[model samples]
Structures are given as structure tokens and as C-alpha cells.
Target: MSSAAPQAPDAAPDQDVRRIDDRSPWWGRLRAAVGRSRADLAVVLLFLAAAGWLTHGLWPDPGSRTMALNPADQVLYEWFLAVDARALLGDFGLLTDRLNAPDGVNLMANTTVIALGVLLAPVTLTLGAPVTFALLAGANLAGTAVAWYLLFTRPLGARRLAAGLGAALCGFGPGMVSQTNSHLHMTAQWLVPVIVWLVVRMLRAADPGRGGPDRLRLLSSAVGLAAAVSAQVFVGEEVLFLTFVTLLVMAVTYAVVDRDLARRALPAFTGGMVVAAGLALLVVGWPLWFQFLGPQGVATGLFSPHYFSADLRSWWTLSPLSVVGGDDAARLTTGPAEYNTFLGWPLLLVTVGCALWLGRRPLVVACLVSALAMGALSLGPRLVVDGQHTGVPGPFALLADVPVVDGALPMRFALVVLPLAATLVVLAVDRASASTGRARRLVPAVVGAALLPLFPAPLPTSGRPPVPEFITGGYWRQCVPPGGVLVPVPPATPRDPWPMRWATATDVAFGMPEGFFIGPHGRNGAATIGTSKQPTSALLAEVATWGLRPAVGEEQRRQAERDADFWDASCVALTVDTPYADSLRGTLEDLYGPSTRIADAWIWRV
Candidate 1:
């Protein structure tokens, strides 16, 4: 059992009550939010330092730089720019024709990072999206860690040192670093703690034996929880979904293990959850409707569950994200930055060992069971052992066909298990390190040896070329009217949203033909992205792809005019020396006469 005294559910820990942040009024909470404490400031500094080191390529300047080979990062940059444009324009619609042109896309279905977009609007406006991206990338990991640290210390009854250990594991662990590859939604998990904290408080207040829930107080707490969940929907619906699954698993397991306590908790738990869900639905109903039923919405089952499921050996391996590992160690499980659960043998053993050792403790049991359940679900229907698919089905079979849940990647279920492992490991480390016996002296050495192999490397980044003078120096602005379409020669594809670099840097004053984003593919609303090819554009794309020019005849000429009109193209700009640039220029010249010289390119007004 945990070496802590149990208290009434409604009672605050004496230590927590002593803290001014908890006891003081709104001003004190505001101070805490602003991170007034020395420890909090230290965490911020640490995070800033980490961000600087990780995104060094984007340092000292961003408008003139980019991160190469990170399509996800690139997509997020567009989102920042898009959100900024929409907010400033007073547009409430999440759908846009800026990319995927005529088809447009429902931004709600994409990783729009709405919460981050709104929260960091000031920074984005002043500094640009790349800097915002870089800062948020680092802050997400650090902030999540700090949030977990606070929760562990205050509510979970862990020591400050123990909380730090857990926070470090939760913040910069392999799972988090892997997500930093490009997934902002998964990375920006700071609100998860806030939601969890609120839920715990509500649950405590709901305990009937502790004078029961005061109707007004319980309703208010329910509202708070609802707001948190609603906020999460805009932030990361997948993470929100995963949170629900994690809590449900924990609750179910707890009920199974402790029947009497389960009975006592059942009514309050259900009521609180019901109220929270209802209120959350009210807040997100319209967006949810647009996401599912509006134009460009996609169907479930974006990818095969089994294909994306975890390899059994992945849990015991290391990834390139690990500081101590080489390419060989990294290759043992999947490619770089995709290792969802490369827990490594040492950490896995330590986590399981701790869970077994602490099985008697209710809190420990809950954490362990939740982690194990998520791990099982991550493995998908078919077991893959050492990259070989075994014919056996797995635990995820139960959820494989379930609506929005089915849209989630089975492998990403490991995210829910991540914090549980961190919590368990920290608890074990705290008990061992804080002991008075001789074991205390050896604890550091043993723990270091086990954890050293899993230490995360600084995030890997690459340099990209800066925005072209055409856009930055305002040449494109001269050619295209505000909000007019400036179709690039080789527009943009779903896979290569390269033009977005210019689009975003130009502050999204104009739209492009097609850019990187997901939208409806066919009559059935299949999820697809990238450019849809028509005749003239198709010919141009083929030329870009193969360096071969097709015959541009009368039909193609008419098609080109139609395409330009369709895109509402104010000017057709061709960047010199881009793939098949010569052919594209010749074709456009045939259709619309010689192009006028522009900065770094030629433009023909539509």
C-alpha cells in the first residue's frame, strides 16, 4: 500500500492548503498562472533553453528559414497562418479555399491546433508562424511535464523530487519527443492536467459520504470540467478521445478490484461524467456537426488498424530519439520519430516490476491496469512479434469499428500508458531514494543505469530556404489583389505543400490552387488530400514529375483558361528553374502570351 494516510474525499491535503496559490483568491491563481514561483520560472527557462537547442536552425531569424523534411511541421505552419488570417478577417468558418482550392477543406478535421492558434495569436502576429511553431514545440513538452509535476505533488501526494522525476519522464520521454517530429496536437497536452485536476476535484466533491455534493458546487465543477473537455476538442480531439479511454479503463479496473469502493463511487462518477459530456456537447455541437456532416468531411478508417498497430518487440526497443542509441539500436523498431512505444527493455522491466511490487496499493493498481490496458489496445487485432504478424487477434478488436474512436491510430494508444509508466517509475524511485537504509545510497546508480538507455536526444531539425523575395519584398502583393488567387506554376500537392512556405510568409493575403491538407476524396467522402488534377494542371504536374512535356493542343489551351478562371487566378506566377519551369512557361505563353517579368519569376494576369 502507498505510505500515505487516507483522508475524506472533500478534504484538501494540509500541505496543499498551506500553499498561497491554492488558498488565495483569484489574484493568487492569476499569479500562479503567470508562473510567479521560482520553481515555475525555472521550468520556463529550462523549456526555453531546450526549445532553443532543439530548433537552433530556426534561431536568430525565422522569416528567412524553414525546417526541412518535416511535412507535419510545415502543415502546422500553414494552420498558424490560416488561423491568424481567419481571426483577423473576422471569419468564423474553419473551412477554407486557400488550399485544395475549389474543393477546399474542413479545417476542423485536420490538426488545426485551434487552442494553440488562439492562445499564441499575439506571438504569431508579432513574430510569424515558424517562431510560434518552434516555441510551442518546446513549450508543449516542458509545460506538460510541469503540469504533471504539480498534479503529482499536490493531488497524488508525491514528493517534489518524485514529481520532478515523473515530470521529466512525462515531458521529454521518447513518446513526447517522437511526437515533436510534427504532431502539435499530441505534443500540446498541457491542458490535460488541468482537465484531470478539475475532474479529481469534482469527483471528490461528489463523494456522497463527505456531506454529498452541494448542488451548486457540483454543477459549477461539472461546468469547469466541461469547459476543459470542450477546450481539448479544439486542441486535440484524438488526445481527448484517448483521455476518455484511459479514464474508462482505470474506472473499470478499479471497480473490478474494489467492489465496495466501486459501488460507493459509481453514482458520483457517472453523474459527473454525464454532466460534463452534456455541457461539452453543447459547446462543440456546431463544430462537431461541420466536421462530420459538412462538405469535405471524411469517413472513418483512414488507415488499417492492423497496419498501424504496435510491434510487440517495440515496447522493449529503443528509438533514434534516445540520446545513447545509435542507428542500429534505432532501426530495431520502426523508423525514426515513429516509435510510439519504444519503452526499452530496462524501463519496461522497471515499470512492470514496480507495478507488481506495488500491486497492493489502490492508486498504483489503477495506474498499472490503465497502462496495461492501453498497451494491449495499441497492439491492434493481430499480434506482430518482431515484425512478423502472428495470426492472433488482440485487445483492440473491441474498439476497431467504433465511430470516431476507429479514426484513431491504434499505436497511439501508447500515449495514455506513457504517464502511467512515469507515475509508477517515479513512485518507485521516490521510495527507494528517500529510504534511510543502505539501499538509498545504491538507488541512484541503479536507477541511472536503467534510465540512461532511454534518455531522449535533443529534437532533430533541418534547415530550409527562406521565403523568396517575390513574396517577402511584396512583389506578389503588387501583382495579386487582396485575397486573390496567385497560382504558382507547379501549384501545390497534398504531399508537397512547398508553396505554403510562400503563402504563409506572405501572411496568407492570397490563396493557392492546392496545398497540403486532408479533404473529401470521392462521392463517399473518403479522406484524401493534395491537388486534384484537371487537364492543363495535370499536364503541368506530369511535366514536373517526369520532366517530359506533353502535346499542348487546342483542348488543353481551352482547359488552361477554364482552370485559371476556376481558381479565380488574378495572376499566374512561375518561379524560374522550378521543375519543368521551361515547359510550363511555354505552355502558358501559348495560352496567354509572353509573361511579364516579375521578381524571381514571370507572371501572366488571368
Candidate 2:
């Protein structure tokens, strides 16, 4: 009877308990992990879809469609990709003569982006540069958003919804969208967050009370930071320079705001930064040398600081890329691709209000200080409001003459404000959500109102001029030898880059005497685009532009022959449908003696 009772009561209960407990530890933990992964996956997919929507203008037909506002920059990037693709196939050189012919161009001196090109060489060589460019543009936007989202959620402890919102602002904000119009160097910022995270880790490791300074952690973080910085240099040195400025401002602000924490963190922070700088030098030193002092290098700055400076009114204006207040704000910006800070007045007002509300947080204070400092610097030497010069000098004037700083477009300083603004918004929302009724509701409502007007619109695009049949159909092989020049009717100058498109279309099969690229001009090596003008090219350009055939004489014909010999010309080809084709053809016929109508071009064998 006792055995029967024990079996009935304990046996069934023990079996049930074992079954439940055995599954709970492993199965429950696995379920939680899968749920977390699924949430992360959902966020990534959402960001990617948003990126696609933002870049919808280019994906339909990248070969034909071009950024309507900045076709020049788009065409320039395509040429860069083509050069990089060719460079990967054992034709690699920091200085390439493919564009400027025998004089050559210093690739390291320009934003050639060889690292990104090599990574995408397969796509570029297979589907062509146009497709690779479009793919990369979308990937940059999505990848940046995803990276920032991870930083906000995992390290900063922001809620998922708040993090998503903030990351969207960082990735698709007015400045980011404006630069995304073919400025791959600025938009490829996914690595920035990783570097920021590593720095934060170093700071934490420096705190003596937290198990007394972790040397190993500090060293690892420093090495990681160095790797990230070196990679960033290859991606975009301008952005990296701006990032350093922002970080310096933030560190100083933090030190002032929280003396105790700063004292604890500074020792490790400074040490880690020193280590990172040393390591980064080891990696990028040679490339830097090649960029600044190598053959064809320009000694002077490329752009004017004052002209490209952001207008003070631009701070309160809306970006033309935004959904609201777009049409009225065009006059406030330099160009469609340079709308760096059209952070409407409403958003600025809200940000200031939130900063005041979250005044106790040290990180919040640092972000506010950094943003304001960067904003002030973005106004350049003299402040301009609504296209009127205010005659008041800006903070940037103090550093304008400094070597590396001189090259920066002062307006781009506004880009540093974007991530800072995003961080402030996320911290505000996350904190407010933890508070009671009225405060939470008011904060969110105001933020939503401010952000709705700044939502991004699809970018504008137009059809690109098609490549000539002679180049695409491979008929140039019959007239021009493998390593010889094919002098286009008017040549490829900065004003008319159409022939650059033709040269790249052939995968750089033939060199050109003239092209749209920066080259050393004078004894001091001041930067100039395209080669020095020759008599033959000048005459041809004049004829093509005004449809007026010049008076052909023996002297002009002799100059043309000398130019052809100088260029090592194998043939001279003029597209049948080029503008003022008859005038150009007459001039070419007079110079070269006769022309053969082959394929879709008038070919004259030199």
C-alpha cells in the first residue's frame, strides 16, 4: 500500500517538474536570444527600406538617371569609380595618366576613394560603375542608420523606439540627405559610431574605482580606435578631421561639466588617444606623404573658405530636400548639394528647450556646447544673413589660415551638429518617458512637431547624356591603337565633361590630352582643373561653343599637328551628333586633311 501511494503522488509530480525545469533553462534562454535578434533584424530592415525610399530617384536606371542638381559631382564620382576599377586590374598607381594624358593626375590628392572602390571592384567591373555607385549610395545611408541605432540601444541605453527615431535623424537628416546627392565621401559614415563606442570604453576603463583601471581594456580600445581612424582616413579625411574637432570640444565641455568624472577618465582617455594617434600614423603616414608631396600634388587649398561658408539664416531655414518649407529656402544655401544646415527654426527652438530641460545631464551639456561651437564656426570669417553680409566676423576666422584647416569648406562644420542634435533628442525622449504624465506627453508632442517638417523627400534626378556608339560598340579599336590617345573634337574640360563619360565608358581603353581633374598649375603648384590650354584645343572649343568655324590657316594647321604629336595622338574622332558638329568637323578636316565616316563618328587617323 505504501509503495502504491508513493508511486501515485511523487512519480508523476517529479516527472512533470523535471520536464518543465529541463526545458526552461536552455529553451527559454534560446527563445529570448531569438527574440532579440529578430528585433534587431526588424530595425535593420526598416532602415534599409527607408534608405531605398530616399534614393528612389537613382535606382530605376542609374546609367541613364543623374542627380539633377549636381550632375557634375555624379559624373566625377563615376569617373573615379572607373579609374579605381582599372587600378584593381594590375594597372594600379597613385598617379594615373588615364585622364590628363601624359601630365597625369595625383589620385591620392583627390577623393579617389580607392579603398571603397577595391571593395566594390567586382560589382563595378561586372555590372559597371553606375550600378556600383547606386548600390553604395543606398548602403551608406542604411549602414550609418543601423550603426547609430546599435550604439544608442546597446551602449547608450536608449529605448528601441527612441533610438530608431534618433538614428533616422542622424542618417536621413537635412545635412545627410543634401550631401548624399553624390558626395559618397561625406555619407559613408558608418565607422564613426564604432570609433565613438571604442572611445567610450576607454573612458570607462580609466575609472580607478571600477576595479582600478583596466590596462588591457584600455590598450584594446586604443588599438581598435586607431584601426577605425586609419580606415576613416581612406574613406574621408575631411569628415574625420571634423570628427576630431567635435570630440575635442566635447571632451573639454565634459571636463568642465563633471570635474569628478573627468579627473577619473582623463588619464586613460589621454593615454588611449596618444596610442591611437601613434598607431594611425604608422598605417596612414605613407599615404599622407603621397597625397601632399608626391608627383602632381597641389600645394595650395582647393576651395574658397568665404564663398562656401554657411549663411547664418541657413540655421533657421528649411532644406530644399525636406518635405516642408523647401521651395522658399533655396536662396539661403550655396547649392543643392551643399545644404549643410537647414535645421528649421522650429527644430532649433525645440532642441534648445530640451537642452534646458535636460540641463542636469553632463553628456547633454557637452552635446549642446559642441553643437553650438560647430554651428558658430560654420558661419566662416564673416556672417551673412539672407544673402546680406553682416560684417561680423565668425570664430572660424581665427583658424582659417591654419594649413589643413584652410582646405575645409567652413559650411561643412554644420555636419558635426547633426549627430549631437540626434543624441540630445534621444536622451530627452528616453528620460521624459520615464517621468509622469504631462511632461512625457508635452516633450514628445513638441519633438514630433519639430521633426515632421524636416522629414526628407526623394532626391531629384535627370537623364544623363548617352555614351556614343563608337565607344560602346568597340569600333575605336580599329582607328586608335591600344595605348594611344583619342582626341575628342572639343576635348573634356571642366565646363564640358561629356567626353570624360565617353572615355570611362570604354573602361579607360584610350587616354585623352584633356580631362576634368585637379592638377598642378604654376611653380607653386596651385590646383587647377584640366590641362593647360593649347591653341588647338582653344580653337576647337571656341568653334564648338558658338558654332563658328575659325579661319583655317597654315599656322593653325601647323599648331594642330604639333598638338597632336605632343598628345601622341593615334586618331581624332568626333561624334556625329555632337553640338555644332559641322563646324567642329570642318575645323577637324582642315587640320587633319581628311576624315573617314566609320561607325557613328568622323574618324581621322593621325
lDDT values, one for every candidate: 0.72, 0.82
RMSD of each: 4.0, 8.8
Clashing pairs in 1: 381-394, 494-530
Error of 2 at 498 (Å): 1.6
lDDT by residue (tens digit), candidate 2, 1-606:
001011211112212233455458777656666766787799999989988988878877798888888888777788888878886688878888777777778887888777788788778888778887888778888899899998887667666666777898888888888998889989888988988888778877776756647899989988999999999887888888998899889888878877777777678768878998999999999888988888888767788888888998899988888887567677877788888889989889988888898765677788899999999999988898989988899998998889988878999999978889988887777676656778767777788888888888888888877788898898999898766788888888887777888777766767888778877775568877766778999999999889998899999999999998888888889999999999999999999888998889999888
TM-score of each: 0.91, 0.93
Model 2 misplaced regions, further than 4 Å = 1-26
Residue-level lDDT for 63 in candidate 1? 51
Model 2 worst lDDT window (10 residues) = 1-10
lDDT by residue for model 1 over 1-606, one digit each (tens)?
111215323123323334665558988766655643566567557755665566566566655554443554555555554464467556567787666666676878777887777777767777777777777777788788888877776677665555666777777777787887768788888888777777667666666655665556567878999998899898888888888888777666666776666566568767877898899999999888888778776655566787778888888877667876656544434445457888788888878886775555666787898888899988988888877888899988887778877766888888777788887876666665556776555644555576778777666655566566788788997789877888887777766567777777666778887667766774576776554676667777777787766776787778889988887888888888587788777877887778998778889988
TM for candidate 2 is 0.93
For lDDT, the strongest prediction is: 2
For candidate 2, the per-residue lDDT at 454 reads 86
